[model samples]
Target: MLDFAIFAVTFVIILVGAVLYLYPCSRRASGIPGPNPADETDGNLQDIVNKGSLHEFLVGLHQEFGPVASFWFGGRPVVSLGSVETLRQHINPNRTTDSFETMLKSLLGYQSGMGGGAIETMMRKRMYESAIDTSLKKNFPLILKLVEEVVAKWESFPEGQHTPLCAHMLGLAMKTVTQLVLGLRFHDDAKVLGFRKNHDAIWSEIGKGFLDGSLEKSSSRKSQYETALSDMEAQLLSVVQEMRTQQESGTFIDSLLQSNLTERQIMEDSMVFTLAGCVITANLCIWAVHFLSTSELVQEKLYQELDQVLGSDPITLEKIPQLRYCQQVLSETVRTAKLTPLAARLQEVEGKVDQHVIPKETLVIYAMGVILQDANTWKAPYRFDPDRFEEEAAQKSFSLLGFSGKQACPELRFAYTVASILLAALVPRLRLRRLEGQVMEVKSALVATPKDDAWVRVVRRS
Candidate 1:
């Protein structure tokens, strides 16, 4: 038995050696600098996984190496770009697909395909625009109604008591997005809570499954993920069935049903939007609140603007223009929090940047967090200053990579609108104060979140 075990291990090692000899794991460019080959453990993925934080690790790599550095993600050669110019060169002309979608495909065990021809892309774009219009114009009141519910809950909370802001924000986001995007209304709190539970499960699994093989490795987790997907699909299908029976028009899901796409395709698209819409928007609100709490001056100024613009009335689409200071605050929060820290693309053909060659099929990552804080572009990059965004003149000095940019995710516009509405509702009603001496730790997750509870004492404004 011992001899057989030795022979088996020797055979496996030899097989791996032969595979490496025949086809090298990574491509190397002569001028590119990266960690030595010896640093890569367990087929080039260990360095990334073993690092404490992927975002900080990549930032460190860019600081050590130059703008364009080479690394590997699980045997795939990856070149990471850490400058605005470098990223612009690559992403501007090639904004057809987003990194999240690519990551989604991989997580769902699908081949890396960005899904959409020219006509399809046009249709999808139109659909997105229409959805945004309906959401902002026709559905604005509904969203405000949801926000008011959140406000009422907060108002009822004991004074000077800390609340887990993310949970409340996530609950609000999930309901608002689902209602607006899917036209699915929750009649009771229990139903909304049920949907959110499944959403949390699938979302958590997707984040874990991207870098680790946990979904496939752990049978219980794999079953949970599958069950969540199945449950979500059933819920979506029920919505479709109800829409058909009721003959609803001008709904995003209804539009999908009208299209010549399979039920499976519709479900896939809706699920992606629902998951991303809920989580990213939740994180956005959480970070916005955190930043506002940390900067009392900004919060005061924002309140002044809100008071001046809307007066006692609720925020509307028409009034959004006059809320420039609030916009600046949110923009600064996005920049400082560095939400969606990484964007990725695949090199279709050979490319070159500054005497370095990028071979075909190489995975490229745009490190947005590091670039957003580039000292050369912004003054005191680490400081959170809403005034920094007051002028378009100042913005031109640095790239204002907002929710919609060349490399920005498309759903970001929808998420931004939702976040703006939530902020508009809350800033006027409550004052958020962070617990003293609590450190604000930005954690790297599917979306960046606070390392701790992100508790804030909510006080109703007199």
Candidate 2:
């Protein structure tokens, strides 16, 4: 009886796989166009892998199949929605849940074990928004302090020397986010170093996880992932305990502690914020600085803006909005760099968006990088021209997807503020020069990172 039960389960699994392979439910239901097979077992797997980057492969699919396309990733269905009209149809109406979040949850096994009702969603939003509000006021001083610290280190380098921008920026971003999330400085914290090591290991693994689910399948990586998660959880619980004794603090964990959330929920959200906050913001800063360094005209404008509006004074929350040019530079950097190349949503119910039928449970992806670079949406979409953003018309051309308007991600909004303050603190005091003839290329990681990390020369302005 036991042998028969095992045989039956295995047979059922094989049967389902065969059925999915034949029908390709995701595309069959929607009438979307994509690769004919859409499954990895097909002979095209090597060809798709040969494209080098998933972003490039998706772009090719969009070009061949038009707006909505479907394909499989290791048996899971993923549909790419590239056009603005198609994106608005799926994302604008379905605002409550995110596809990327669901994907992460699925990978982490969170959905099977954790609570995720409407109340949980509301609590999560409240925590994120509250953290943004607190960080804007409190994290500004910290951003400037970190900026000055970076400058001091740069000055120590002999004239004409260059440094790896990604490494340094990643460190600065980790410190800034660690302070905001944990309510303490991480630069000297030995435990924080351990946390950072585990985080880097896990993140590097995740970048490879996109190709195949080896991060989950491999024993070594799985053990490492679990250990990192355990360490983070233990540390976050400790932070929660310590926050209980403090009278006041603006740390995200402290704010969540004051809320009605259970300790587990708070820890879960803290880990999300910590991981997401560090890499995305670091890439944002690195790319923005890289673009500015390359564009002498833009750098002069930025210097002029900083000199006129701030001129050696401290950057405060009150003064942030007044730095309009800095905001435009950041916006342009995000567009040209395509920092966040994708946004995703899961259609829980059958939905129609602009004549496109989206099947229920479809993992609809917004190919943001493709959309932002669509020639119809902008003049010279590939060019790094911040002045183009001065026009209200240009700003309205591409919705930042999950960064602004009603469907904004609060953490990204907070990132904009943090990055703006970093620029404000540094631009007036330093002249950034891109190393001559070094071409910066992009790769899809947890977020987009330089294919080769950016290197730059920083000289203090006299």
Candidate 3:
């Protein structure tokens, strides 16, 4: 017993010593924002979109602390810009690659190997971009068929049955994104069962880590995240093999897999693309419906537009141009819902954004949600107004919605088309109603999702 105590004490001391010695970077006061005693009113902001509420808090700070307000969270220095013009000028074409990739590395368990240079990096990113272009043009119709199957099956559930609308939306989005990107399906009875096992382990571990930042300290997180990556990769690899066997021209994965890309790079790019696409697209759909339910005016207007454009006809790809109002409603939802409240960049050394000096390695977060609320760029910014997207001018210049021009999300181009087509096709066939007493909330992970299931009734429309 005495010897055991001695060993235990020594082990803890040594462990503490080692963690301090090996990962000294963790000790810094990285001002990554979250809940703090100093920031209480931000609870509403945090509630609206969790994680990094500091960006909103910064709005208050900028009011109180001036144009350049620097604050601390998680030992990081976070800087927020008050001016969009200044931000756009300083913003790079590529997102400033950050240490979050370290978490990806642990999750995916890929060796830290580097082979490709500028051409290779550009090729990989552009190819990923280009393949999305191809999938949007090629694979989405197949996804629409699957969604149609899901929705057609869905309409039979009775008027008040209250099916899991959130899950179904999420599922269709996931299936669409994965199949479109990889050109494979995971709906196989056995493969789906195993894929669920793998996907759950991956999501749960990362979820806990995001809330607690325990992944940085726990070997178990490192292992679980990695194992999930490996399993996902294995699944993707098999799909890639099938794609090749089918003599498919090339897919996003097939494109990267064929090139001189490392497994880590392929897995990283694929995972990010698929995960981001699935999440943002689905949540945006859910949020859009939520908005429509709350704003009957918006819903009726959109339905009117649908009625005028493609009356009682299925939303063919050709008619997307005609469904302009529906696109505006979705756009306003992105702005009001603020699905991605903040976009971040890491700067190690002090840098100048025009005149202001942001000290080095600062985590500069664009308060995207707050920015959307600015009266200058937006009219009646707080209200859920979709009309902003109605005119020829608004439609043409609606580039601020993340996927505009160069900064536009590659997935955005495809997501709305699929979502709108689904909406136009199904809304005409079904009547949707919000289930009584179901309050919608937001949870911010990689992207924001409904806090609880968005329970709804899908009755077949006459």
Q: Flag the better candidate by lDDT, 1 or 3.
A: 1
Q: What does candidate 3's lDDT look like per residue over 325-372, in tens digits? A: 887877788777766555555554546776666645455655565566
- lDDT string, candidate 2, 1-462, tens digits: 011001111221222233333323454435676776545454235445567555677789889988888766444556788876676567334455544444455444454223466666765677657865775576667777877887788878887798888877777777888888887545575755667877766555544543456766788887887787677778888887878888777778777777777777677677777877776778888899899888888988998998898877877788878988998998888889887776665565777766667777666667887887888777898999999888876776555455444455666676787788778767777788989889987765225667666799988878
The clash number for model 1 is 0
Assess each prediction's global lDDT (C-alpha) against the native: 0.66, 0.69, 0.58
Tens digits of per-residue lDDT, candidate 1, 59-143, equal 8889999898876543445677887667655633344445565455444543312355746655654554455455446677788
lDDT of 3: 0.58
Among these predictions, the greatest TM-score belongs to 2
TM-score of each: 0.86, 0.87, 0.77
Q: What TM-score, to 2 decimals, does candidate 1 have?
A: 0.86
In candidate 2, stretches whose alpha carbon ends up further than 4 angstroms from where it belongs are 1-28, 38-47, 73-77, 112-115, 185-189, 209-221
Which of the two, 2 or 3, has more lDDT? 2
Cα RMSD, model 3? 8.6
Give the per-residue Cα lDDT of candidate 1 at 52.
52
